[model samples]
Target: MFPLEHIAIRQAAYYHPEKVVHNDYYLDHFKSRGKDIARFLQVMGREQRYIAAEGENALTMGYQAARKVLSDAGLASEDLDMIVFSSQTPEYTYPTNALLLHHRLRGKSRTITLDSNANCAGMVAAVEQASRYMQSNPHVRYALVVGSDLSSVNCNPEDEITLPNFGDAAAAVILERRAERPGFIDSLYYTDSDDCENIMFPACGLSNIYNPEMTPEQIRISWKPFDGTCVVEPAAADIEEVMRRNGLTLDDIAAFCLSQFSLKNIELICEKLGADMDKFIYVGDEFGYTGTSSPFIALQRGIEQGSIKRGDYIFFWSVGAGWQLPTVLFQY
Candidate 1:
């Protein structure tokens, strides 16, 4: 078991772009291509989504989320010992978004900063590493874990399956080390590299190098290929294993905060696990799929909605582009 001690989420916050788009906005565009907008929304289970404005990107949204979390926690920028950020849509190919965010926050020189690119599963992966750092280092007291993505930019407007399912958002949480508390419990992570292409942007990375000669418009348009079925079985096995190793059952979990893939997928998983569907918090219908920020946003919403409470058991899980699955159970 990968149990953690003395590490707890002190505060959590999230930020969505100011611009919002409803599914109806895409109706005419899709209908011209012989695609039904109503059927698409019925399958994906999302009605509206937020899109980043012209100037807004991962860094700006992430900074806003981090600043809000720090303010809510009554902490200063200098008090942070580390900052861990996760994103697939960064502002630049170099200098790393984490380092840039550290500068934006005016974090102390001693603050360790780095980035993890796990796509939708990014936040849980960051939490695992941040919790380990806080547990091993007595000097480290507080750390900021962030997950943000501007997925709408990479979506192909003509692609019926992926175009309408994405949204832009950022979320941050402050984790503090305590003397004694029921905090993080075991976590399980799995990756199936064989299916990596199921959800990926093929043109922007090293394999397909960017062409300097191409026009600005040509360089800006790229599509992310996504297949939702790739992770279903693997995620189920991972969740079952985590529960078995922790000696807990589905009945023991007070809430389930999972990636906002779809309402259908969530229902299927709940049925497969024999867990109560009411225990899962879903924000995708209103916020759309916020990439890596999905689960954390749901966590904060659960607390605000009174579905999740202190001393409750939370089972958090996410599956990202690389077919990466990470599941964790903890007590608040």
Candidate 2:
């Protein structure tokens, strides 16, 4: 159990692109493919999603979100001790997105920056890392944690299962050291690499790197094919373990901010855990599954809608592409 009493979440913010794609767009796109667009929408509980404009990418959205959180906290880029940017849809394989964001945000040279490719679980994993840093380093006053992804760019429009499920977004939060109260209560992470291929981009990794003959066209065609059903059992087990380890029941949690994979999946998980469906924030209908940014965006939206409040015991959970599951229980 990794718990931090000194680190506190100072602020949280998110950014979505201006371009929007309605369910009608998917309905038309999948008509010839024999996909039941109406049934898909009803099952997934998704209506529309925001897509990135021509120039917008992960870094740009993340930078905007980071700036918003920092500005709201009344701090400049120079005041940050570290920046942790998490995403699978990076602009480039090299020159990590975190460093690029640090440069774009005009952070000081001394500020440490790095990236985590934890997929959907990136946000909670980042918070765990940032909280640990603040706990160990007395001089580190503030750290910026960002989870941003443009999953639309990695999706194949022809694949009905993968196409309408994703939307582009970025979310950021500022973590500061405060000696007054507990911040992170405990966090548990579980992964099963055997199921990694269940959700993956087949052409973007070492296989393409080793095979120089692979062209850009091959890479572009290699979109992620996901099996949404594969996550249900693992998520249920992980959530159970987290609760057992922390000695808490479903009723003890005030709010549950989970990955915006789909409303059906969220409801299934809630049923498996015997959790109240009303306590879980549902944002996929409006935002689609924003990949790593889902949980943070949901948390922000819940707070905005007066559903979540301070001193409440909040549970943050997500299952990522690598079959990674990270569950965090904390007091807000």
Candidate 3:
């Protein structure tokens, strides 16, 4: 066989603010609104989540995580050939969050930097995009992909869907090209935007950000509840397809790093796929739904906990808002 370019994960780390918000914290508040906070927590399988402290946001969280990953890998800013920041809760709309991060890291002038927002599935998309970009450019070797979100700040205070469920966290991964065995294999994507309007940040739209009449409530996240089950079938299909096309089987995968959106959904997908729950890595209960960083957080924690190891096959899957699914089949 002819030789081919390859890219694979080098290291990954995640960061969360110091504060922890448990289900009990939302009990009285959500109960007063006639909502079943207990059932909600039980159904979601969430115990507690990390919340940004007084001075934290996406940028800060992401930077900390990135620094940790780089430190662990013994890589300096100049070592990276590209930097990609993925988030919907970006700290700045202009100047590009990725570029800002690059500036903070004192990245080399030759490094390519950019920001992307594909909602929750962002990091998955970013990694795939970065891998493809690096594969085509022989000059680019190491790349940084960070996914962070301060969703708690964007959430509506009175909204049960956003306020009580969402949390803040950031995850960073270092990808490097290899010449040997397996690395990034192939990716599959499918989109279903029928419920596109259900979840939205900047409810009033960016154009109205400066409008004098726009109230605080209007600028916060707008979360209209929908059947989250929309993700299950598609997720299962995509996972199977990626494995099929790659000539891999369920037995070949060492772990499944799925979106931390809902534990119930993950359980259902496992049931549908007849896959063992032991192979699935989930950290949503403690971290909550961290938007774009969800899967990466799962990946990092999985590795740290010894659920995955070097040269093992890994499957990654996540769903974005307006609903986009990006599935990746990789060898760690």
Q: Top model by lDDT, which number?
A: 3
- Tens-digit lDDT string for candidate 1 (1-332): 22435888888899998898998877777988988878768767898999999999888999999999999999999999899889878777578787888888888998988888887888988887788778888777889999999888777667776678888999998888876676778788887787665555534544444666654333333545555766667777778898898888887888899999788788878877878899989999888998888999999999999998888888888987657889887777
TM-score of structure candidate 3: 0.97
**lDDT tens readout by residue for model 2, 227-301:** 676777777787788779888887778888898887888889988888889999988888888988899898889
At residue 136, candidate 2 shows an lDDT of 85
lDDT of 3 at 49: 95
Q: Candidate 3 — which pairs collide?
A: none
Pairs clashing within candidate 1: none
Ten consecutive residues with minimal summed lDDT in candidate 2?
216-225
Q: How much is the lDDT of residue 138 in candidate 2?
A: 79
What do the candidate models score in CA lDDT, each in turn?
0.82, 0.83, 0.89
Per-model TM values vs. the true structure: 0.92, 0.91, 0.97
Candidate 3, poorest ten consecutive residues by summed lDDT? 1-10
Q: Given candidate 1, what's the lDDT at residue 209?
A: 47
